[model samples]
Target: LMEEGYFEPNNESGRNRDVYQFLDGVAAHSKHMQQEGEARRLLRNLIFIFEENDLSQLRNRISELILYFKSQYPGKKDLPYIQQLKGMLREWESDLKWGHLGFNAFHVHHLRLGFYKGEIFTETPRMDRDVAPLLALMQQVKPTIVTVALDPEGSGPDTHYKVLQTVSQALRIYQEEEKPNKLEVWGYRNVWYRFHPSEVTTLIPVSLNSMAVMEAAFETCFGSQREASFPSYELDGPFSRLSRKILVEQYQDIKCCLGREFFNESKHLRLRASHGMVYLKKMTPDEFFQTSRELKKSTENIE
Candidate 1:
């Protein structure tokens, strides 16, 4: 090829010396390896080299090497080293076995590095004991309906949905020991949110005061007591409105709307307006967002 001038020694085609060096190293090591362990080590080194150099050509080289092995070894049982390396290489090519290569490694590395340096992934953060305010508010209001609205403008395509899913998951866990109230979700414009108060006949727009009250409830129960800030927005009297009649007209309607069947009077407890504040008092913001985002992301991604 070089004699035909199709390639050159130091031109663009030759600029990637790392590939040649790696191939040469693999060839030299493969030739001298007599023991299975040594062969396995060389194969691992080649894989590392390919990964480090981003040499996609290594994939083709892998195929060629495997073919060479089959031709040379001819199903010999003594070839333990070749068999191990071959099995691993084959596993890497399989979608089910190697599918995690796309994201899991990055996720794990990010988590590990965050732990080492004490940094947070804007995507995820740790929670501490601080959620007392929201719990208190919940106890006071005894709101059968709780609405969680994510900022439409600030959210990405999947972000809003994930936020709602996170909230729902938390609700599920919170109500595991006791039956939960009927929950409903509303998606409009770009906003995704949930409304609570299992028996609400209509949704009255939540007021600034109501949001403040809700924020306080959330902070006490689910956020840092110092300052649990949710997204801020301009609002007037009745910040939110929903038809309560739609929520509890029938169990079928509820199931079709929310995809959650929490309506059995025996299995699900009704929210008592008087006892709401007491219920809210039990909340702590320790793991509010920390445990939810990943779970939410995973949930939405799968769906």
Candidate 2:
């Protein structure tokens, strides 16, 4: 599409030229494919093309294609292309399945966390209602390690900060009753914000192959967020790409500060151009709870 002049970089203004050209190209392609009786081929080509891009872009393109196909030939499932497309869509949906709580059930099952049914906080913020269930869940799990985003006010979204506070509150309640064997809290941030070198206590190295796998998982698992309404203004690509860039930059910083031998000597660390590092900050349960409480109070004072 770029070579054919169907798409170009928006040098004039900060707009998504890719998205506009993509939708146009798909519409034209669908029409041509239908006339040529190559709808199945078109579907195959779409799947192949999107695999090269990020999850959000792929999701958006797929959604547009699906709508185009349905409108072009409604109630015609008996057709070969239509049947194949429907089957493909069914498989895709199944693979990217999510629970009512907006979490991948497959991930939860793999982690062996028990599921609890509850209403998702969409419109109104229900602190007590949300915290109560999480507290109960924490007591049941008795997890030694708890990880939450270190998102502050005015971060990517209010939901991230809210979730952190809720988890912290639940942990505080759980600790009051019983202490886990080795309780630890890990604060992590991605895309919107990242921890400075001074703030990071842990630097975990990731292999190039693992990074590729992570991108694939994001594309396949987060089906709903494929077409984000509020994408990052600074980053033109998907969230996964932003995360990758951050990790790589961190690794580069470490190599510049510490000699290459540091990574070479470490048995667990592997160095490569494609390899990346994730930074994390460690905190005590009480410290996390206190931070959460302070955040809550600060927000309240502002209101």
- The digit string of per-residue lDDT tens for model 1 on 23-88 reads 344346643331332333344445544443233665677777678666773224424444444443
Q: Residue 59 error for model 2, in Å? A: 24
Question: How high is the lDDT of residue 211 in model 1?
Answer: 39
Prediction 1 global C-alpha lDDT: 0.33
lDDT of each: 0.33, 0.59
Pairs clashing within candidate 2? 56-226
Task: Determine which window of 10 residues in candidate 2 has minimal summed lDDT.
Answer: 110-119
lDDT of 1 at 241: 17
lDDT at residue 223 of model 2 (Cα atoms)? 47
